[model samples]
Target: ALLGDAAHPMRPYLAQGAGMAIEDAQALAQCLSVGNAMVPEQLQAYAQARWARNARVQARAIRNGRIFHAQGAVALGRNLSMRLMGERLMDVPWLYAGGSEVHGFNGNAL
Candidate 1:
């Protein structure tokens, strides 16, 4: 089964390539270790577990890339908004909280 970059190629803006790789490894291992599951079913489980979370990360990374590379008026407005909002603008609760259900292991390690 594919894992890490082979499964999802993420942009560098969010600096999540390595982090996602670790998560992928964990999810894959967890799936594979489950008893009574065939290899194909285990692989499918891994994919299902990671698909949405990886998509969300990829989308956020692309968006951050655009915001980071903004030019002219957009850049100016972005900077002003960031300054006004401060750290609150950078806080992503969904990302940092890291819900286990999305990982599909229910907090158990392989």
Candidate 2:
């Protein structure tokens, strides 16, 4: 590989990424380990929490990747819209925050 322009790797559209994987794995493993000690409702809650959140992220990542690869007006619009939207959207708490499983998906008791 030869050096060229600096590269900023595109964020994985899947969002499960490294951080998500760690969180999901830890949560899943812990939830699973509890076995019969964990109620079915809580188990369902764990799945609901992980799947819903990750699904949303994966969708957005795919969309962003498509936009990044888009041509003409579509590309311009996506970039400009993101610029106008500010960096806060880029620094999403939901994606980067490490403790999502501490309180479950909605942050209330599961």
Q: Which model scores highest in lDDT?
A: 1
Model 1 scores a TM of 0.87
Candidate 2: residue 8 lDDT (0-100): 18
> For model 2, what is the C-alpha lDDT against the true structure?
0.56
lDDT of 1 by residue, 1-110 (tens): 87779888999998888888888888888888787668887788788888888899999999999999999999999999999999898777887766244333343444
Question: Can you tell me which runs of candidate 2 are displaced by over 4 Å?
Answer: 1-11, 14-16, 33-45, 82-89, 102-110
- For each candidate, what is the lDDT? 0.81, 0.56
Q: Which stretches of candidate 1 lie over 4 Å from their true place?
A: 99-110
lDDT of 2 at 58: 60
Please report the TM-score between candidate 2 and the true structure: 0.58
